[model samples]
Target: MSFEIIGKTEQIELMASGKAIHDLSRLEKQYGQGKWRKLKGVALVRLRNGKIRKAELHWYEAHGIGKKEIKRKRYLD
Candidate 1:
């Protein structure tokens, strides 16, 4: 499943606990990993000065635990 963030980016908090890595591992265990691909929509990230920037979603994957592990990369536009 994909997540869409609403509201200001400042309101969003990134949890440490390796959540992102774990999630990607789980996804790879479920589905096979493949070449990096581009997503449809752009993500809005807020800077410290309250500036919003658009970024492209790039998804890549690697083999892990006999399955594919996925990693998401965001490229600023």
Candidate 2:
């Protein structure tokens, strides 16, 4: 499964310009595959300026053939 944002990136006013994708294999190793369904966790990010921010995590669900955004959650600050 993958994710896509909802707008034209060039048009966004102030989107995060830098990104760091973490290797979540440790997560799967710690907590098996059973918890991923219907549970969109929060993203804990540390910006270059040294401030921590949280972002909502959205996931797509398989329907017929295509997928849809079926879950979302707000991150805690």
Candidate 3:
């Protein structure tokens, strides 16, 4: 990500899971597979320029694989 997640995420919701995730195959090949899910949430982030902001984040996660490919979707404030 271009920014660092400063704290815990909030309002987390599942956008997709399992076969519903279009990138499921790539996620498995890159990170190993186990009930992979595409999730979204809002969190405080520090941008590369050292500015802090609340942003919506999206990523892929699995039981043992942890979170991968985290991206900042948009700024909340």
lDDT of 1 at 70: 19
Worst 10 residues of 1 by lDDT: 9-18
* All candidates in order of lDDT, best leading: 3, 1, 2
What would the TM-score be for candidate 3 when compared with the true structure? 0.96
Cα miss at 56, model 2 (Å)? 3.9
Candidate 1 lDDT over residue span 5-35, tens digit each: 3353332222222334545555545665533
Better of 1 and 2 by TM-score: 1
| Counted clashes in each candidate structure | 0, 0, 0
lDDT of each: 0.40, 0.36, 0.93
Tens-digit lDDT track of model 3 for 36-75 = 9999999999988999999999999999779999999989
Pairs that collide in candidate 2 are none
Q: Is candidate 1 or candidate 2 better by lDDT?
A: 1
> What residue runs in model 2 are displaced by over 4 Å at the alpha carbon?
1-37, 44-52, 62-72
Model 2, range 1-77, lDDT digits (tens) per residue? 13333432221122111122132344345543322222244555444566555656544322232223333344356
lDDT of 2 at 10: 23
